[model samples]
Target: MDSAGGTLYLKDEDIKLVINPGSIEEGKKIQISLENIWDKTSDPVLNKFETIVSPTVRCGPPGTVFKKHCILSFPYNAVNEEWWEFTLLVKENFQDEWRRIKLGSDDKDIHFYLHNGQCVVNLIHFTNVTLLGYTINIMKAARRVKFGVFGKHSLNKYQLRVRTWNSESNMEVTEDAKLFGEKLVEMATHIDLLYEDLVVRVQDVNNGWQISEASKTQTFSADDLWTKIPWRVFKFTRSDPPSDVLEATISSSQATNVFQLKISCETRQENIRSKVHFWYFISALTVVVIGLIIAWTFDNFQAFLTSHSGIALFLSGLIVALITYSIMWKLVKSATPAQIVACVFLNMSLYYLGVWMCFGFVHPLTTVNIIIILSVYIIAFLVAVVLFGEIVLKFVPFIGLLGSVIFIKLMS
Candidate 1:
């Protein structure tokens, strides 16, 4: 082996293995026995080998042809007056090609590198050991970078962890945890670079995590979702969410401690439009029936008016019943099954009484006509109830009472 070149050749009886140089620091040659070497597996060290550096290891076992001792060379320029020494343990899962140590006049800087799926530590203690690069993974919208306690449990109190926020689109740098949970605040606080279309940021409070994802086009409201969704954290993985959305409307109201938020994202827009169109179609058909009645009245105007006040009364009552039931069901909770049944009977009975009084009692023409026409107005009101009442009921608690008050106030 060349002494000046920082090379060491290992030999065991008749067999030999050549060790190579790395770029980071100065290399050294050492003499040791293969039998006395650390088993590496049983006393597995942390960051001391390539396979174990990563939390998840996909690699296999170590080879058996290693030399008892070997020489190493430093690829990078050596620092002045520094002596290189071999360490038994190195950082875990390190696969770098070179391994070197920096030494001072009185003290040596501990060098770490992974080899043979193990962390080889040459010394028990050394000073001025600096770690070059470390990494962790994160997801987009993941709000927390917690320390002192790791994962969902506190098992890894002193364990250092680093993770990035991963969105379906991108990933960003995050915190690092370490020794006895010290230096945790520094490790947990992180702000990632903003991306092209999506900008993501995270905050770690004493108790919780907050993540905000904003888009170039728009930002949706995320109020009160903490209670609705089971998770305290949220991650958006897709550039575009996959869901069937028909229609979307945004509205807000206040009740109790929480503000009521209404957002509708329908799976099929056409379906909603079809339902609305059907209602309008029914309304138009009713208008046509009214037109027919008017035409017949014009032909035998006086005779028809005199004889069919009863029919007019019946039609008016039917209309009122439809509208009232529809409105009550949509807007108020008080529109119960019993109330609905009672309302229907009352309206029908009123119609019969109005008609009988118009003919049997020879009531005044204006009184009889007014009663009949009023019944028609009642029916039209019911139709209106069916059209708009249902939509209002979802937002109005105590449905009918609230709806009625609001409607009357608004109308007046």
Candidate 2:
């Protein structure tokens, strides 16, 4: 908290951090990592007598001590009945030994409480926390489990979330979901039904789909060393431990899943882009070709850049080539390597050809003239070889430029 008495609260999903005023020296904003570490399900304490109810939530830099008391929350699942009999476990600085803390009276400074399906802890300092307890199994509690796909799959196929929930009626669950637009109600506290109930062996009707992921590491600065963040695709189920969800994973290695990647871009912007590439290939190639024609004609017919017509042509070529390059970058949809290569070469040839026409001044010793001529031949050769290759569209512009080049040279 700052001197202004503004409440400082940082939260992601369910993990929360609320710093009171003067918790860590006055007026100092410290670096915190609540979302940096990956979620874990196993620990040494569980091997003794405790049953793991939820995946371990990790926060860091280990051994961070707070001057004043601060409030922190941990999300938990009711693995079985008697969920109230949970004991909070704290692991400080990645030590082998773990400390057990019970939920005590709030009158004291260091007590925990259950609120809205999460355990709130007010302590001086921390790193990691886990909930441990056992519950009685009730077979009658089983309900119909349903799954739904969330997020725009076409735009971003790399990573997507598949939400699996258990309930009786679809209509009731959906009507209940409408209350929170971007939040999951599965973790909310209830009067009767507990949120941590697991629906085992939920089958995915959609076959041949995989939940694949690559983790990413965020570097706040070049100096601070941080661990690599691997992409995780966990099945964030509403109820119970991950044991049921883990069994559901098929080809995927982790708890995450992925749909296959396609060859072409699937953005809604593709329709407009498809129409433009054809015209752009033609127009960009023509402008550079026109510039080359003007430049070479000026070089041979008149002193280069001396005449008003020559200067205007040179400026036009430079400006239009620049504009074409700018427009090419604006087309931000996912593109094939072939398309990327073609665009790069087209833009390069544009600026290169714009100025390359001056080789007439130094004697055309198989200079740019021969290069453009060979380019046209190569394009023609590819058209003949591939019959209908993608390059054919991008290279068609070279043919037009070839015509202009030949016409201008002949006239000169």
Candidate 3:
């Protein structure tokens, strides 16, 4: 079709990428063949591009709907490179076409990128011939996957600048989901205790592919990677398998208590692992006693602090540390002596840090206030993310004890 001012025009469906742009030394030639139309019924039609284009069929009365499918193929002959890149120019109807339709301005060229291999283009069009305007959809499957449109139909005519976007929704809950409920009810042994079950879920969130048993290397955004899982509900049983598949098991037995697992920022492990720890009545009482002792110590030494601000800072630190320890307790019901000792020391250090900050142990000359503020904010955010993690541990009697022991040692 000819646009107003004698400019040439191509429908959106006809958009194609070119390959093998000639070098500066020699002229380059590219031949585009359009064929193989697919219908709405999923049937394919192999036809020549020239045979399908008719002036009468396209340049009709305004507001007419028109649709067609075609594949554009081109050959490549570059000295070394396998692909070519160029912009596709689109123009609308011939009669007064330029006035009725709008093409992208020079500043924003509609460029095309093509590789040497054969490619397919699916085109669909709707035209208001009287107005000399058209709506077009082009699906470009080339070395790079891209779908685009070009037409002066109207402003806001194309939202997001592209069309023909399709997504698959595979969220059907099947009969197997019922297995989760039945297992929970069957495993319940006492009113005060509940059996926690863990079901591993694995799915491709993006276009990336995943392997079954093989370690599937994947990258996640910082937010997605740091997002916390509900450890209170599902305890990590065994090490995460080195595959995309999730392995989670729940047990009423204390030995199988679960721990929260996070993706390591360094290695980006193929599978995230969580360990299960046990809880017992003895552990819970011990934790509660330590908490009381710490509270008393703070009360007895209230006047001994050098600065009120430092005291406030120390109290804040203690609160944050206790909250974090509580969360860790809920995360693990059992642990080795080394783990318990490590958690306890970490908690003590935090408690002392609170006291020191309030008492001005960290000198203002060192710019410690800035560091303290930032640290407090981080701890608060983390605690919010793992909200009620420790509370969940208190429900399982024996495991709850173990969780308390870990929580207390970590805090004390």
Highest TM-score, which number? Answer: 2
Q: Report the lDDT tens digits of candidate 2 across residue range 1-412.
A: 3422223233433567676667777676666655323333225434322344433555555677777777777565453334335677777666457667765644343567777666787767755766665333332121112344222222112222333432212333344345422223122122122223222222331322233232211111111101111111223221211121111221111122122211211224354355446665566667575656555545445665575545754564456445554555354244433444465456545544553454444444356665865486546545543675333434434543444455445535
Identify the leading candidate in terms of lDDT: 2
* Model 3 misplaced stretches (Cα beyond 4 Å): 1-71, 74-237, 240-412
Number of clashing residue pairs in every model?
55, 11, 27
How far in Å is the alpha carbon of 407 misplaced in model 3? 20
Winner on lDDT between 1 and 3 is 1
- Candidate 3 per-residue C-alpha lDDT over 1-412 given as tens digits, one digit per residue, 9 for 90 to 100: 2111111123423323222222111332222322212221221121211010101112222232222222232321111122222222223333432221222224221221334432222222222111111112111111111111111111001001111110100011112223332111111111111112222222222211122333221222212111111111211111222222222221212124222222211112211112212332344445446545554455334544445753564455446445545645543433322344345445544554454444443343235644654355346434533575333333222222233233323433
lDDT string, candidate 1, 6-97, tens digits: 32222321112233333112354433222111122322322311111111111111221222223221111111101212232222233422
RMSD of 1: 22.6
Candidate 1: lDDT of 277?
41
Which window of 10 residues has the lowest lDDT sum in candidate 2? 222-231
